[model samples]
Target: MEFDLSWILLGLPLAFVLGWLASRFDLRQLRAENRQAPKAYFKGLNFLLNEQQDKAIDAFIEAVQNDPDTSELHFALGNLFRRRGEYNRAVRVHEHLLSRGDLGPADRDRAQHALALDFLKAGLLDRAEEALKPLEGTAFESEARLALLAIYERSRDWPQAAAITRKMQASGQGDFSARQAHYLCEQATAASAQGDEATAHTRLTEAMAAAPQAPRPRIELARQQHRQGQPGAAVDTLATLAAQAPGALPLATPLLIEAAAAAGRSAEALALLGRHYEQMPSLDLLEGLVALDRASGDATRPGRNRYVEHLAKEPSLVAATQWLATEQLEHEQFHPQIQRALDQAARPLMRYRCAACGFEARQHFWQCPGCQTWDSYPARRVEEL
Candidate 1:
């Protein structure tokens, strides 16, 4: 039987030609698509540089559509959407990247992080937390933990914040002792307010153990003790604080004096305050000493002499005002008005100021309200600073 040799020979060339044409067509299409993708991407970049964000986003979306497998394009598109405040679109872009089976581990993490950021920016805290939770084992672990900490803090979930901080501390990220102390102090405050004195005491004690150098715990514990009619214990606690955290003595001084007077330990309190004044020479310490002296009916020096001595050392307006307030002026008629004005001016100088953000407050804060920085406020007053 004739096997159609002629047809086979003819068909072979035809098949080869068909294959070649098909291959050429495919290559052309691929090159055209590749060129189109870059063209769109570059157009987007140009628009972005020109501050035409709307146009840039359109171009990026086009590029992403043309090059669906391009991770960089997806990232660019996601960021663009986020920058445009289109969190939903940003989330979609990042989520799509995360869903891809061929994504690298690092890229997967990046996508997850982007998704979290989108949710956070959109004020979707719950979704953001969920997105950030899986980032624990990735390079984004520290960043995710920090974000999670912020979330918990904003929600006033102290327990969760403490857990994250402890985890971060254990991982050697940085010291979170002070933050932990603050969380415990917050809990203590709440417990004390609820009439749970024992729980408050326990929490404050734990806070002190967590960060001995932190002043809030000791101060709070002493206040609690004073409230519970344990003024002697409160004075003892404050003395311990003055010894352990001397830089915080100014803040503890008034409380210490109150506790000492209530506990009939004015003599001991005066001695401790005098010692602190000798070492630190703070106006608050001097005030504490004077108050204690008056309460004990002991005149170590004239009540105004301490301010004079402080003025000689520091040239402080606050000190000068204190001295003048107690002095018999030649023009005594105007003294009251003058003292009131001087005191008003000095009040602001006595307030604490945050070093990081220049936020001024009457009380010293571990965190700056303006910038949310921890340990931003110096121990010294605005004038001292």
Candidate 2:
């Protein structure tokens, strides 16, 4: 075959031109698709900023359909569904992401976390726990463990909570000793309620060993001792607590007074309480002092007069009520009414208040019932606070 040089030269440039034209057309098409994706994404963002969650979800859905490979958009849409309380839809989206083989490790972990959140929001605690378990070796380990701990606490699984706390402590998540002690105390309380005094005693001992500086263990242990007819041991325990955690002495004052009376250690308890009253002058400690004085056969006037002294230091209505309760009024007939009003006024002030959630209760709580916060209630009464 004869070669045609002119034709060959012309064909080479024509083919080159054709190839360039096709490449340009493909690039333009890709650019148009990319532009549509961002337009939908921005529309979703605008709707979200406007708090139109339904519209935002629609826009995001459109964006996701346009760019099916976009992991970020999928995550955003899933989270929006979760925020809107559409747990089922959120779970589906995150599960879809997880099913994708093309997803990176980080995205996979994020999808898992999002799925767990959906389950948690839906109150599917079992599923949530299962989802969170896999995140232990991942970057979300701390957060997942914390969530797990909360779940265990809410479920009253003391042993599980303690185990999680131990792991957190071992990981240097921060000192969880106090929390661990609380868990042990919770276990002890359950055991005591079930009449397992031996188990309760062991758990309480463990709690005290876990956090020696914590006042709850010592206080609880003393109460247990008193209940077991070991008033001397109870008094000794409270004395140790008063010496170590003096600020918590007010919380232990009533128990200490009872223990002292039972153990014939009134003089020693009186001296200890008097020393604390001099330093801090708490209403509870003052009450303890008055009780001890009365028990020791001190003069009636001087023993009850501590309330008047407390009133001199603090303008406390509770103190005034206490003082008036023991006083001989000039208008004796009207004294009952006045005392009743004062007593009513001081009743609310005697409540314990949660520092974290402002919840008030007649008795002290180591954990807040309102917000499920631990160690939120201070050892002082509301009026004292």
Candidate 3:
């Protein structure tokens, strides 16, 4: 049992040598793995900066595989997939991130938001709504609510849209009173279509109270009153609209003139319209005045004279054509053809144009069909603008 000390000392050095070699090997392997991960990540970033998305995606996938537990890499890859319109892949990536037990609260919320965006981009409204609901009180709450509002609007769910607008208003996310009024107006329109005058009236009244400065509510309310055999009330509502939002009077000029005729208040309507035209010389206002003048049997300030007056103020092809239509030309044989050509040229100038997107329409729209922007079209026509 008496062993030699030489054997013990010899075994110790050999074991130490093996341990050092193994440590060096492990260090080299770790360094190589770290290098590969960074190399792939930087390569992906370079590809992205160069606008080579496909190559960037391949590099990102390689980077993610090399470092599977990296949350940032997962986010980048998920966002890239979403940008590429690969919603299914984006959803999977974000869902996998959400499923990870080690992920932090913020990261989980981000993943949830990303998943919601993927659903929204894929035109899955129901799924997007479901995914976005849990993000309340988080940093992504505002964005989620806006997306939800847009979805509700797209689906014509005015009540939901109004509720979201209220919440956004309470949170100091800018004034949404205008939008709230629009929603109520939309709801009122639907009610009126279904022959529910009481509900429509209530909604329109609420809309006016919600945003008195908003022109759409008053205009809609006036229309409702006029349709319900209350022309006097309609005139009063429109008069209030003109006083409150003078810029919007042109949009309701025809209705105003009709209501004035129905209510037998042509003199007051003429005065109000003339004052407005004096302040703002819109073609619509001029047309309203001319219609009332022609109907009044007053030869002094004739309807055609107003066109001549408008021409003196500003050169308008529309005004010139209207004035010429009543003139006794020396060469009257081709008058019809000349009138037709002039009318055709003047028609486009009478169309309204959207301020936000430059979309033109023969009739004004509260919301632009082209850009989906509310109150984009001004009351003035393309010529006036």
Each prediction's total of clashing residue pairs, residues at least 3 apart in sequence or on different chains, is 0, 0, 0
Model 1: how far is 98 from its true place, Å?
2.7
Instruction: Estimate the overall C-alpha local distance difference test score of candidate 2.
Output: 0.92
Q: Using lDDT, give the best candidate's number.
A: 3
The candidate, 1 or 2, that scores higher on lDDT is 2
Write the residue-wise lDDT of candidate 3 on 277-364 in tens digits.
Answer: 9988989999999999999989887799999999999999999999999998999998999999999999999998999999999999
Q: Which candidate has the top score in TM-score?
A: 3
lDDT of 2 by residue, 196-280 (tens): 9999999989988999999999999999999999999999999999888999999999999999899999899998998989999
Alpha carbon RMSD to native, model 3:
1.4
Clashing pairs in 3: none
lDDT of 1 by residue, 220-300 (tens): 999989999999999999988988998888888888888888998988888888887788788778777767656656565
Report the candidate with higher TM-score, 1 versus 2. Answer: 2
Worst 10 residues of 2 by lDDT: 295-304
**Colliding residue pairs in candidate 1:** none
C-alpha lDDT score of every prediction, in listed order: 0.89, 0.92, 0.94
